[model samples]
Target: MSQIIGNLSQIGGDYDALFCDLWGCLHNGKQPYPAAVSALQQFRRAGGRVCLMTNAPRPNQYVIAQLDRMGVPRDAWDLVVSSGDAAQDAMFAGAVGRKVWHIGTEKDDGFFTDIPGEWANAPAISRVSLEEAEGIVATGPFDEANEAPEDYRARLMMARERGLVLLCANPDVVVDMGETRIYCAGALAEFYEELGGQSLYFGKPHPPVYDRARRLMDLGDEARILAVGDGIRTDVKGAQQEGIDCLFVTGGLAAEAFGPDVEDPDEELLREWLATQQMAPRYSIGRLR
Candidate 1:
């Protein structure tokens, strides 16, 4: 593992392109981290191609607007690709003229606004059996808090039995929605897998989305991309699996995970943590900023 004392500038040399994660690495969803933003600006000033990749269940434009609202300047990155964008493209690829059952919050429905198809509140709206559904597009968390969780499970089983393709718009299982921890569509997708169902996940930690971002920058797989984010499951694991380096920010997840006592965990502690998991990142930082 390599350690750089200060900001990203300390890391010598310039990369041809950079594939960055959005949520925790760029901002905490509420506000942008000044240091992180400056780091990106510095990288771009050095002529590095930066692509902001996020697992948000919204289109690229929506993600960009959110970044703007969070105070992250438009020049922070060159391009953006959201998990929702990939899911929407995939959905349209298969069912161009068919109807679909959208299982998500109203805010997420904007992804399907321009698609050439009809929307059904529930799978039963089309009088089509779960097996007959052209495809299942899942966006947000569906639980008692917001929606009925049982209804979500039942829909998954129906889709599986009918051999309907399941498309996950949000790849994150949960995120820090400001001070509140809320579940994402990824939680339901995991449960569906446990029940022997097939699902197509679009988001961080998934190779396809990363591949798309790389293509956008014209960078090959050998590019020295640093995946920075606060989520261990998505940012770290995703980077490791894709054979790239990573920088883990400790400001997200269970914020309690890092403290004066546990801060700067020794190599042994890091190894112990990785022993229980299938992947490990190359380095860890307190926070990007």
Candidate 2:
């Protein structure tokens, strides 16, 4: 059985660094949770480094701006690492190549910035349509709030026919945006895969993102690192696979399985849910507080 913690202080001294998930753990896209913010702030004040690791398909600066707008204190985290950053690294490393068809909103263009080369620097990314590109990069649906995977059926079919490999920046299927849940890029990638299109993910539950976070933290020893998040598939599983202990919060993303409202989940119910998912975090909490 997993121990339910009311405060993060119970295990704060056990870790030198924390790789914390952004959306579900800290805020729900609309605003920051006061308790969650205070918990991280408290942890950082205790000498532990807090790195906000997120699958958000935008650059770190965009997320920082959103956090600022939401009134989340700037001191809550020491660093921010995003999936878009990981995808850009993969793109420049010849993993996704230079010529690509970007299938996302205009806000996602930040991922295609210039990269320094050994010579006069490689040209900036050449954005082409599905018919002219060698690969496809998907951040999310063009209209996340109003579109679903079915909306991209025709587009995905065309890409599949052209044999364009997909590089997905965000691995989350759906995200809680304030009071509403919206589809994300991972949902589209799953549809593309079903259409026989090859896809690569650069976010959570994938080793590349975690590897990037570990390098950014530069904290030695995975044993001294604590992973915190709300999703079992992405956060808990990702941390466990990375050989780091995880702390799961029940009130976000996985709230449905925990309880009907944002209260402590039934211990046995949570245990059964984790058993079904084949995940057992080091600790479980209703919220980060």
Candidate 3:
């Protein structure tokens, strides 16, 4: 474990660019954390460059628009990179003369619209259709309240029958959609894998997402970059895998994971949890704000 540092001011002097995480550290899926926003603004004003990185499945433009609505100004960070952006990059890389059956909301169609590919909507296609399709992209239409595991199972079975490769845009199983937890593309992908389907994931908790962020920031191997987020599985694990420092915000995924009784887990308890996981953030705080 790396030596944990408590001061935010120390971060400003040590790192060249910050690869910050969204969803948990910056906001709680409803509103932006005032303290966190102020800290980032202060960091930028003090000559630090911050690159906001998120696991949001939507394209960069959409993510930025959402953040803007959430009161997080675009100028808070030097750059923004999302899982959607990386998925789009991967699609473009292998999409020459290929047709894709995109299973996602209409908003996500924007990610593939201008790209060099054809789109199709088939819950299940025949082997002939599989021969026609180069790949299958699942973005998430599965709402836990409306769609069940059977629905995803049936769809994956159909895709497998046709021998189509699967690409999961959002690797998150669920996200805080206001007060409710809604299913993401990852949930469907996981079920598909259980049924003997091949799936590729692109997002945080996965190394590729951080790798792309590093490149975007022009960060070298030894560059000190802090990954601040709420979820231990995604933000914390992702930073640890990349060998970068991290700051875990308490009010996100681990809120209840820490315990329902304790609304605010102190720094010592947080440190104990990190020690148990073999992961330690350079710092830990109650909320991003």
Candidate 4:
């Protein structure tokens, strides 16, 4: 049973660090949440470490630039980790071959250009048509706001028939952009799997992202770590599998399921919903604060 908590301070002392999610928990993709920023700042002030663990399909540098633009304070977090880091490692190592079909808008092109220094001798990746590609690299939809998973049914069917593997950079299915929800790379991955295509996931609820984050968040006493995020499937499930306590932020994705008030999640509804999803977070919060 996940207990509904008022704030992060209640369990702050019990943990040594936090694996925090980005989008709905810290910001709505456009700006920073003042309360959420304060909560992380307070946690840092009390000698806790914060790693901004995100499923964003871009390198840590790109994410840092985004945070800066969003006005998320530098004091709020100690380090950053991303799903792109893990997926990029595998892609460069020839997990999906050298030639691939690229999905995602021009903003996500950094994923192709921003190769880490350590992988200097990695196989060069190139973008090609679906017919000439060795594999598929899907960051997200070319147009996230207006596109749906079914829109690529025929394309995915063609890729599936070719037996090309898809490397999913981000594993989040949907994200709330302020008040509007948009599909993410995970939706396309799900669709490909439904079409009998092979899709490899490297983000939350998968071990690759957690493994990379753990390596980056190296601490002497690494046992006490808390995961704070809104995605039940991505955040809570990932933390649970990693054997860490999670602070489920109900106000983000599942705000309506709890009740009318985003600040005060209905305990009965929260418990029932967690049971239905088969996830068990030790604690729950209406928001990150």
Reference-based TM-score of each model: 0.83, 0.94, 0.82, 0.98
Looking at model 2, residue 261 earns an lDDT score of 55
Clashes of 4: 0
Which parts of model 1 have CA positions greater than 4 angstroms off?
1-6, 12-14, 95-97, 115-132, 142-151, 260-268
**Cα displacement (Å) at residue 113, model 3:** 1.5
Which candidate should be chosen as best, given lDDT against the real structure?
4
lDDT of 1 by residue, 112-218 (tens): 76442442332222213445567667787634145534557777787677676667888788777666677777777777777677778878778778877877678
lDDT per residue for candidate 3 within 75-185, as digits (tens), equals 678888888877766666663224777667776766775342232331222212434666777788635447645676666787788766787888877777667777777
lDDT of the structure predicted as candidate 3: 0.71
- What's the candidate order when arranged by decreasing lDDT? 4, 2, 3, 1
Candidate 2 collision pairs: none
- Candidate 3 weakest ten by summed lDDT: 119-128
- Higher-lDDT candidate of 1 and 4: 4
Cand. 4 Cα-lDDT: 0.93
**What is the C-alpha local distance difference test score of each model?**
0.69, 0.85, 0.71, 0.93
lDDT of 4 by residue, 85-171 (tens): 899998988888999999998888988898889888787899999999999999999999899999999999999999999999999
Of the pair 1 and 2, which is ahead by TM-score? 2
- Per-model root-mean-square deviation over C-alphas: 4.5, 1.8, 4.7, 0.9
Error of 4 at 94 (Å): 0.6
